[model samples]
Structure formats: structure tokens, C-alpha cells
Target: MKAKWRIVFLKEFRETMRDKRSLGLLLLFTLMYPVMLGVILNQQIKRATKPEREGIELAVIGAAQAPNLMVQLKQKNISVEQKGPMDEDAITQLLRSRKVVAVLRISDKFAENYQAMRPARVELWFDSAADNGARQRDIEEVLHAYNSSIASARLLAHGVSPATVAPLQLQRYDTGTTAARSAGLIGSILGFLFFPAFICGLSAAVDSTAGERERRSLEVLMSQPARTWELVTGKWLAAGALAVIGITLELFLAHAILSWLPLEEIGMSWRVTTFDLVMVCLASVPLSLFASAVQIAVAMNAKSFKEAQSMLSFVVMLPMIPGIAVSMLELKTALWMYAVPMLSNQTLLREIAKGEAIGALPFVLTFFSAMLPALAAVAFATWRMKSERYVLAV
Candidate 1:
């Protein structure tokens, strides 16, 4: 009986492998991930790693009052190109056309207040879109250093020791390993990290069998004397295998690029481990099954392939909905979070990235949570496959 089941499973696997789309998507998973992510990460790194330079078209709309500040900016290598008296609209246009990095509009009282030793107001206009922020931050840092230097110089000029201006030094103590820091940053930026394996398997799984169901070939297979569950499991495993292959390749590609590429030029850096990848693949198992089972069940009820495909695109893309939040929100994942199918997988993968031991409780609950949905979907799909109307209905 067992041998017969194996025969059926292998047959299902071999049959699905024949379709070009199934084969391509399977291979694509293996190849695409590493290539795509490597490119993106390398670009990010390059942006971040650009050499620092000191030249920006700054339009100063105030009087030549802050000679001290101008001297300070000049000392920092910033070229102070004062654009003679201009209104807000003119300055706005200058910024829009990239005429200047920042337009400093002084409230005519700037000089008077400087003499009175009072803080004066200044409007700095910038086309933040083009600024890229990094340069602006450097400019700001230079200005801050200038400000501190002047303040300390004045204290000494007033007969106060420079030490009188200094209070206490603040230092950061990072007790964790390098991996933990890298994981925290990576988790925030690459929220889509853990999804490829599950999604790749999901599409192939649904298409191989459920797709065939809608195409009427599945009925041909069902009409044959093959055991039902054996046939289904065989198909499921085939899709799963393809998914695993694709995901592995993608992981390799992703790591190669992220680890090797010039990422600092693009304002990014990343690191991932073999262990992190294994956990991702491990977590992907249930999701792929659930995705396949849900689609199979849905397609089982559909009268046509088009209907099934239309309805199931949502199911196929279900794992991607929370993508923005996953990447941007930086929320902490607790043990109870493992109860959520996709979320748990991400949490465990993140832990594995940090070389932290995932507690057994979260492990069981997460997979079990995913298991519930998968079993229900499989049960419904199995029962539907057994029905004569379901098998042959128009």
C-alpha cells in the first residue's frame, strides 16, 4: 500500500514538472532572488559610501550681518553664495530648479539681534526631495561643530576656561554581538525577506494541481485509479520541492549581493547567515501548504480555470499585504506573535539571524497555528476531490 502511494506521489511530481510555466517559476525561485536583491543592496551601499565633498549652492537672503557665521561656514569649506535680496516666491523657484541647496532668509533684524546677543530667526528653504538628506545632515553637522567651536572660543575670550563649557561625556555601550545589530537593521528594511520561499512554493503548488483541476486534466488524473490523498500529497510535494529550490537559489543570490556588493554607496548594508536561511525555508513549509490548499479548495469549487485564477490571485498575494508595516514599523515580535502564520515565520527567521535561540513554545505554536489552516484547507480540498460533482462539474 505504501509503495503504491509512493508511485502515485512520484507520478504527480513528474507530471507537474512537464509544464513549462511550472518549471520556469520553479527555476526562477532558485535564480531570481539572489540576483534581484544583490543588485538593490549593492546600489544602496554605493549611495551610502559616496566620498564626502563640500560644495553646495546656498542662497543667503539676509544682510551681510553674520560675518562670524559666514567665516565659520567658509572654514568648513561651504561656499556661501549670497543671492541678493529675494522674496519667498523667487527663493522657492530657485530651490525648485535646483539653484541652491538651501536658501537662508534672514528676518532683517538678524544683525540687530546678533549685536544684542539674542537668537534671531532665519528661514531655510530647501527642495527636500533633491536633498537626499545625507548631504543636508553633513552640512548640519558642520554648522553644529562651527557653533560649538565659536561658543567655546567666546567662553575662553570671556576669561572662562574651555573646560567650564564642557559638562560630561556621553558614551554608548553595545554589549551584544555584531550579528544582533545587523539583524535589527535588516529586519526593519527587508520586511519582504522571508516571503519568497513561501510565495514561490505557493504559486507552483496551486498551478500544478488546482490549475490542472480548472483545466480539466486533473479530472483525467482523478478518473484514473490512483489513490486520492497520495495523488494530492505527491502534487503538493512537487510544488513544495520547486518552491524550496527556488527559495534556496534566491537566498544564495540575495546573500552574495548583500554580502559582497558596494552597499554603502546606496546608503545600505546587510548580512544574513546559512542558519537564517534554513529557518526561513523551514517556516515557509506551512505557508506554502496553506496557500496551495486554500487555492485547491477554492479552485475545486470553481467551474473554470479563469474563475479559479481570478479568485486565487488574492490568496497568492496574501502574504505580501503587511509588507510596508513589516519593513517600516520596527515592531517587536512576542511569543504570541508566533500564532500568526506569516508573522511567526518572520520572527523566527529574525531570531536565527541574530544567532538567538528560538524558544520551543513559539516554535510549536507558530507552526501549529499555520498547521490549523493548512489542515482545514487540505481536508476541504480532499473532500472536494472525492466528490463526483466537484470532480466533473461545469
Candidate 2:
């Protein structure tokens, strides 16, 4: 029986490899994912490392009214362009031009109000629609520092301690590390990394089952002496093997790209080592098998290649629902997450990227989560194929 299945497996595997379209798809997904990921991450790193003041161009009107404020702004590395007094319309045009981050207008009564110990009016004009949030925040910080200095000086002049206004001095300390903060973003990225396992063998699975039936060869194969389980197992392994190869190569290439790039620049880290990646690939092997088994079981029921492809396409996306729902809910990881197939694999990789030392249980759960279902799918397909109805249809 084992020999019969092995012969069937080899035959199907050889036939799948002979199909250029299937092989081309396998290669495309294997290379496309890592290249795209690297490009996106490289762009992010470049953007994050750019100089903070590179775009902080501020236009200040009524510079004479607050000469000291102008000096303070310049000291904070802000590039201030002095402008003559203008109306709100003119200021709006200047901001709309996008040449400057923001405009600062000092009222004409500013100097008089300051000398009289009254609150001076300073209007900050900004385009809220513009992508100058960082620059605008920097300008606001400088203005805040200038105002606080003036208030402290006024309090001292009145012979009162400035500290009297601040009974509570609270200092903020952020305990979140860069890696910890980036875990969520990286988790989303890694969630799609395993998707190729389903995609890589989709064409092969559809063609082997529905395509053969459409071509009238499935009846011939069924007439052979091999039992239903042997034929079904052979086809399942053939498609699953393609998925395995595609996913393994993809993981290795992605690991190389991630390890070479400086993810730390964007407050992210790919802390997975070579050994860890190999172990991950090993654990993920059953995912490919599960995907292929499910595809074969569904596609075998279709009357034509197009119908099978359409049906399995929807089935392919079902695994991603759990991952998406988990992300949307912002749920913390629990032991049960390890039993949820695709979600478990995603969670495992995410925890590994965060440099966590998750022990052997996740690996065990991840393996069996897919393996058991895969065996069940193959069994069902075998039984379905043996049915009198299926025999008559073929």
C-alpha cells in the first residue's frame, strides 16, 4: 500500500513540476514577498533617520515686537523667516504654499502688554491639513519654553518664588523599549509571511484534482488497483510538497533580508537567529500540508478548473480572518492562541521577533493544530472520492 502511494506521489509531483505556469507562480511568490518587505522597511528606516529640523521652516511676523522670542526660537535650531505684518488671508496663503511649517504673528500690543505685565497675544497660524506635524510641534515647544521663562521672570520680579505656582512637579519616564513598541507593527507584517504556504500550491492542487476530472483522466486513475486513500494521499503530498518548498525558501530569503537591514533605525528588530528561523520553518511545514489538504478536498468537488479555483480562493483567505480579528481586537496572547493554526504560527513568529523565549509547547501546539486537521481533510477527500455518487460523476 505504501509503495502504491509512493508511486502515485512521484507521478503527481513530476507532472506538477512539468507545468511551467505552476512553477512560475511558485517562484514569483517566493521572491516577491521578501523583496517587497525589504523595500518598505528600507524606506521607513530612511524616513526615520532624516534630520528633525530639515523641514521646520517657520515664518515669524512682527519680529520687532518680540526680539527676545526670535532669539530663543533661533537657539532651538528653528529656521525663522521674518515677514512683514499681513492679514489673515495673506497668512493663510503663506501656510497653504507649504513652504513653511507654520506662521507666528505677534500682535502690535505685544511690547506694551509685556511692559505693563499683561498677557501678550501671539497667534500661531498653521495648516492642519499639511504633513508638518513634527515641525509644528517643535515650533510650539520653543514658544512654550519662551512663555514659561517670561512667567518665571515676572514671578521673581514680584518677589515670589516661581515654584509656588507648581506644587506638583511630575517627570515622565517611558519604560517601553523600541523593540517593545514596534512589536505590533512587526506582528502585522509577519502575519502575511506565512500566506505563501497557501498560495504557492493553489494552482497545482486545483489542476491535480479538478483539472484532471475535467480532462476525463480522473476516471482512468480511479480504475487503477490503488485504493482511494492511496490516490488521495499521493495527490495531497504532491501539492503539499510544493507548498513546503516555497515557504521554506521564502522564509530563508526574508530572514537574510531582515537580518542584513538595520531594523533598529525604525525602532523595530528582527531578533530571529539562523537557528531560530530553521526551527520556525520546521514547525511551519504542517501549515503547508494543511493548506494543500484543504485545497485538494475542496477543489476535488468542483466540476471544472475555474470553478475549483474560485471556490478555493475564498477558502484560502479564511485563515487570514483569525489573524485580522486578533489584530483588530488588540487581544493579548494567551496559551489557547497556540492552538489556532494560522494565528498560532503568526503569534509564535511575533513573539520570537520580540526576542521572547517561548518554550516547546507553542511548537508542539502549532504542529498538531495543522497536522490533525490536514489528516482529517485528506481522509474526507479519500472517502468522498470513493462514494458511488463521485464515481458516477467522474
Local error of candidate 1 at residue 318 (angstroms)? 4.0
TM-score of each: 0.72, 0.91
Q: Write model 1 residue lDDT over 1-394, tens digit each, in one string.
A: 5665567557656766667785776566556655676666655554554324436556777638677777776676666787688877888788888766777676788788756767666676777788446655655776678567767777787899888756877899968666676667666544455555456655555565556766778777777777777676666565556555665566556666667765444433454566656656666667656656666677677777677677777766676655455556756766666787777766766676676777667667766767789778777777777878766664
- Top candidate on TM-score is 2
The worst-scoring run of ten residues by lDDT in candidate 2 lies at: 46-55
**Candidate 2: stretches off by over 4 Å:** 51-55, 392-394
Residue ranges of candidate 1 with Cα displaced over 4 Å: 21-43, 51-126, 160-182, 188-191, 197-216, 262-271, 317-331, 359-376
**Alpha-carbon local distance difference test for all models:** 0.65, 0.87
Q: Pick the candidate with the highest lDDT.
A: 2
Candidate 2 C-alpha error for residue 21, in Å: 3.1
lDDT of 2 at 233: 88
